[model samples]
Target chain A: MRVPILSLGEVLVASIQDALTDRGWRQLQADLLAQAGRRPPPGSRRKTAPRGVVIDLSTMDVMDSYATRSLDGIARMLALRGAETVVVGIQPGVAFAMAQLGLGLASAGTAVDLEAGLALLAEQVRGDGRHHGA
Target chain B: MAVTMAPESRLPVRDDGEIVGARRAARALAATLGFSETDLTMIATAVSEIARNMVEYGGGGEMTFAVIDGDGRVPGRRGLRITATDHGPGIPDVERAMQDGYTTGRGLGLGLPGARRLMDEFRVESAVGVGTTVSMTKWVV
Candidate 1:
């Protein structure tokens, strides 16, 4: 199934609700990249470029090495498109397991929850004035 | 440890969907054994890693789960044992395979070592051109 991606002004949000299959992950990557390249509908007031992307994993209870690689790949791909990636809502248990497994997403920003994630994105946008003011 | 409950289930690991199914099955069993949310998540993650490895590198395999009762010294100790087996080309070097950042596939190379860390006990046996089997266990405190 396609994980929905919601656009909030200059930031894109995707809440992963379930364990994704390999195909689902591949599709999500393609969809996110495609959405990032989309232009504001002719004469729309919103900004044409996305400044940041927030991936909420609150509902997800488990992540394996493959999933970790997928997240890292997505972050790298978004960086190439000039968008910062923030992964939020990692549970304490999941964090422990990830650390034990030596899985780390070094390139992406991480936060405790959705609010912090959005705030982090906003801070990034404000810090780099080029992507501010939708 | 004596086998208090020999309850066992086998799941086919052929694709990504099957891998998720295997994780769910393992989680359900672990949950019933009074595993904490953290423990459940750890077991599920380990299951996923091994199941995926079976499908990816082992050319499809099977996952078997069983419950074991601890001895008198460790009273009330219960653990879930998960075994994954595949009849495919086996790992040439188990030592290198267990090392971090050593992957033959397009992955982060954390599957074997990561799964081992998440579980209390881990054992693997493989022979070139024969097959591979990985067994892991998580105990309840």
Candidate 2:
């Protein structure tokens, strides 16, 4: 399915606890990738793929190597969907640790203020103006 | 009031379940001192990574969780102690293991150093064949 690039409205998030399970997230990512390849229903108003994902990692304070890599994995999966992910509300220490582990904001995608992230998603939907084939 | 600590809890590193158990224990200890949800998640993620490292690299081992009250010297802090030990071949070089993206397998070598970043204190002791013990503590004041 060719991921649409203009239909994004509200962000979608998979189950956090579920994704954290052993290789469970990997499977989800795969499913998302497959879904990304499809087009919206006939006569849909939106034009682009859904604005990727907004991981509400606000509940996180401590992170280990696995979580860092898992995040990267999630980011990579989203990219396959032709949508970018924006991580918001991350604490300084957590952000620092992620950078130390090489999971920096830039490596995965744009790390922006919450407002900016929403705006970027809206902008992507508005600017594309073309319905990408599914 | 004198309180006793939980004796080490150990489980084979067979799956993420083991990691969850260890993180739950760590979170419970953190809760006793009023840790925020963000803090709890951080500790959980860190512990989960270490536990995964034990299973993947160490060929499986066990994890331990304990609690500690930071000494006055540290000022305004209490802690939850988590230790994951493995009998499998110990890390050849602790320093190298701490580096990011340093992995021998399809893994990101963020386990050790990532945990250190999440906690207020981190210590590691390992010997080739002897074993490895990683002790970490997250503070909650």
Candidate 3:
């Protein structure tokens, strides 16, 4: 499934709502990175690119090692584009599996879910959670 | 030592699609055996890794699922047992391959070791140019 990238002012959101196949995940990575730091598409009123990215994985039930490493890589690449990436909504079961597997999102900011993830990104940018919503 | 009493269900795993199928089959089978939610996730995840390894490096293979039962003989050893066999080039050093962070492909090298950690019983048999077979059992507590 091709995930739609939504914008929340300066933050971009990619909510994965389906069970991902390999081809599906590769496409998602490409789509997110392609828009990470690029300027707003032509004919838009926004003057700035996304300052942060929120990847919501609440709907994801299973997260294997390959997907874990891919997300870690995406986080680092997003940093290179000047966008801080927060991975949120990791399912309890998936989190347990990842821990047992020794997989981690070492370089990215992690939170319980979308709300917490955005707050984390906000704090990183201005040291205040309220700043991003302003 | 546990005894498996049910007939085994076998599936041919040739690609990513089959990998998904194999794991889903695992979940369904485990649920029927009354495995807890957490255990179901663990079993499915382990099945995925081993199935992926079969496709990525082992040149595709066959996966089998068997339901183990105590039958009043083994007590709480009832659970799900899985075995994956592949015809692709096998591992040269099974010990090193079983270590965490060891990989011969583009993966994180967590396939074998990570799957091993999730299951209760795990073993691997391989010959460099011959093939590889992995067997794992996740017993319900």
* Best candidate according to TM-score: 1
lDDT of 3 by residue, B1-141 (tens): 456479999999998888889999999899998887788889989999999999999989999999888735567568788999998899999999999879989888999999999999999999988899999998778
Q: Candidate 2: where are CA atoms >4 Å away?
A: A1-19, A41-63, A88-102, A107-119, A129-134, B1-12, B36-39, B69-78, B139-141
Evaluate residue B133 in candidate 2 and report its C-alpha lDDT on the 0 to 100 scale: 89
DockQ (0 to 1) for model 3: 0.74
Each candidate: RMSD: 2.3, 5.4, 3.1
Ranking by DockQ: 1, 3, 2
Candidate 2 lDDT over residue span A46-94, tens digit each: 5545656655455455555666566677777777677666665566656
- DockQ for every model comes to 0.80, 0.34, 0.74
Candidate 1 lDDT:
0.90
lDDT of 3 by residue, A3-25 (tens): 88898978899998866778777
| lDDT tens digits, residue span B17-122, model 2 | 6666666676666676687766776777777778888878787777766666545566444667777788878888888888765776667666777677767788
- By the DockQ metric, which is better: model 2 or model 3? 3
Superposed by TM-score, candidate 3 places the C-alpha of residue B104 at a distance from the truth, in angstroms, of 1.3
Candidate 1 lDDT by residue in tens digits, B80-133: 999999998999999999998899987667889989989999999999999999
Give residue B20's lDDT in candidate 3 (0 to 100): 84
Q: Considering the two chains of model 2, state its CAPRI-style docking category.
A: acceptable
Q: Between candidates 1 and 3, which one is better according to TM-score?
A: 1
Model 1 earns a TM-score of 0.95
Alpha carbon deviation, residue A90, candidate 3 (Å): 1.0
Question: Which candidate leads in lDDT?
Answer: 1
